[model samples]
Target: MSVAGVGEFGLIDRVTARLTYGSTVLLGPGDDAAVVAAPDARVVATTDVLVEGRHFRRDWSGAHDIGRRAAAANLADVVAMGADPTALLVALCVPTDVATDWVEELADGLGTEAAGVGASVVGGDMSASPTLTIAVTALGDLGGRAPVTRAGARPGDLVALAGRTGYAAAGFTVLSRGFRTPRLLVEAYRRPEVPYPAGPQAAGLGATAMIDVSDGLLADLGHVAKASGVAVDLTRDAFEVPPQMRDAAQALGVDPYAWLLAGGDDHALAATFPPATELPPGWRPIGRVAAGSGVTVDGRPFEGPAGWDHFR
Candidate 1:
């Protein structure tokens, strides 16, 4: 049935009826505002919006995949601040002609991703619009540890990364070309596998700085470099390009490094740690912090675009 047929209240009830909230949520749906626990006396919050046609295409991804991607983008930001994800407040503006089941599946996707990191969808708002848009606000707890920012890296610190990168961009390329033989890449673009735990873990292990690789790796690292007032030099040899990526690159006749270095949406966590620190599990050393400005590959500027830019 179309959303207009279900009406607002009925649609809300259907989407929220079976959700499971974590302990951080004291009250969930069916209220003017949901209540969440802030045990650390401070809450980490971040918001992101996904607009239909711009951020996603229904022909390429279902409502469920769009919802997961939306939730992951915001949740990853909370974790990047060295906090544990706790709750999500999602607001949707949908066309009246949209299917009600599509919205429910979207809700299911959001709930599933949140639950993966011990979080819940506490509340949200809905409205009618000509275009579809999803805005998610993610809340997190620090567990009493100091929040890691992008400005703490110092010269001589080791740069590390948690989780894989470039898969999503590669997937986008394959899908755009009307080829999906590489299911792995396409799935990545549909739903990123963010390294949620790595954020808080890195904080506990004395991460000097951190960020979620939402924009390409080099672009995001450029932010860290500017904020921390340090130069970042990446060793090209440290990254092992997956064979799948190589094969795809050969088929497409494009440099795989462009995806690895400049692609976004992977949601990997890149952090800087003091020298001599034993890296945490799943974290790999990729570069070093130096005294200077900007980011470089092998002591020189990267040849292509570093990451995503909305206006440029």
Candidate 2:
């Protein structure tokens, strides 16, 4: 049935009925505002919005996947600040003609992704609009740790990465070309395997700086470089190109490195640590922070667009 048939309150009741919240959520849906526990006294909050045609295509992704993507984008931002996600507030703008089941599936996707990090979808709002837009706000607690920022890297810091990159971009290319045999790549694009825990783990290991790689590695790292006033030199040989990526690249006649360097939305965590510190599990050194400015690949400027830019 369409959302218009269900009406607003009825649709909200249906979507929120079966949700499970974490202990941090003192209060959930059905209130004007949610009251979440903030034991650490300070909250880290981040928000991201996904527009239907601009951020996703209904033909390429399901409602659930779209919800997951929207949640991951904001959740990754929270973790990048060295905090544990606690609650999520999702707001939706959908046409009345949209299916009620589709909206429910989207809510399920958001709740599931939030729960993966022990967080809860506490509350949200629904509105009538010409386009479908999902905007998510995620709140996190630092557990008394210092919030990691992009400005802490010093010269000689080791640049490390946690989680897969390039796969989502490769998958995007595959889908764009109308073939989906490379399930791994396509799935990566649909649902990024974000290393949620790696953020706090890196913080514990004395990570100097950190960021969620939503835009390509180089593009995001450029933010780090500019913020920290240091040059980042990445070694080409340090990254291990997956066999699937190589195969996909050959079939499409494209360079996998382009995907690795310029693609975004993989949501991998990139962090910097002191040179002598022992690296955490799931993180590997891919480059170093050095004296100077900007980012480079093998000590030279990257030859293509660094990463995704919403405008030009």
Candidate 3:
């Protein structure tokens, strides 16, 4: 069938029917907004919009990659607040020529990532557009615990993180170097497997402040620093990338630190803990909080652009 023959709703229906809405969905798709049972006192909500050619390229990422990334990015925000993701709503716009299988792959990707974070896609919408765009809203529950916001960090708090840094950036570097995606870096770029459990773990360990390293390490940590009215110092010397990244950076003639410190899309967890608090497994101590504002690297001002912005 031709693009003109397969309309937007027709294509959407084909993909949507395959999705299985979870039991918690009070009002699933075909609504203004899907209603979910918020048993927890607070519902952690986050939304992210990924534009084709900006957030992703069809040439670089598969439909599944786009879906996974779209879901993971928003889900990471809920995790940053130390909340457990419960449900997700996705809205997509695609060109008329887009294939039905591509949409299914996107849904599969979304499902894969959502399931990884203990959530499911409850609702979505589809529309015809010139270029593809995906907007995802993730809802989470705090389980009666207060959110660990960026503003909660206090002076003397020890800074720690869960998950690797610079992998996505390194992957991008590899791509820019005309190299086909290597296994590690390709997976880093195609589908960032965020350490979803780390946020709740930090909260359970009494984390003072938390933020997802979606942007560069320094930039996202700077959010916590500014919000908490504390200074964050990262020991870059202690921040080591896997040997694969080292080789990629060397091949690209780019400083791995640029990717580690300023590259975004890592989706790592950055949190501040009290001096007495025990570090969570899979986390490493990287810095400490001081009675000041802004983020520093090795006790010095980190000289670089802030981070990702839709409109720079």
Candidate 3 lDDT by residue in tens digits, 1-312: 523467766765766676766655787666677788778867899999999988898888899998999999999999989899989988888887877788888999898888776688988877888988999999999988789999999899899989877888778667656777567997798788799999888888899999998877888888898899889888877788778887876776666777788787879999999988888578899998998888888888865442222111
**Clash statistics: count for each candidate:** 0, 0, 0
Candidate 1, which segments miss by more than 4 Å at Cα? Answer: 305-312
Q: Residue by residue across 1-312, what tens digits does model 1's lDDT show?
A: 999999999899998996888888998989889999999999999999999888899999988899899999999999999999999999999999999989999999999999999999999999989999999999999999999999999999999999988899988888888997588888999999999999999999999999999888999999999999999999888888898888987898667888888888999999999998999688999999999999999999877542233211
Worst 10 residues of 2 by lDDT: 303-312
**Position 188, candidate 3: lDDT:** 93
RMSD of each: 1.7, 1.7, 2.5
Q: Would you list the C-alpha lDDT of every candidate in the order shown? A: 0.91, 0.91, 0.83
In model 2, what is the error at residue 205, expressed in angstroms? 0.9
What TM value does model 1 have? 0.97
Best candidate (score: lDDT): 1
TM-score of each: 0.97, 0.97, 0.93
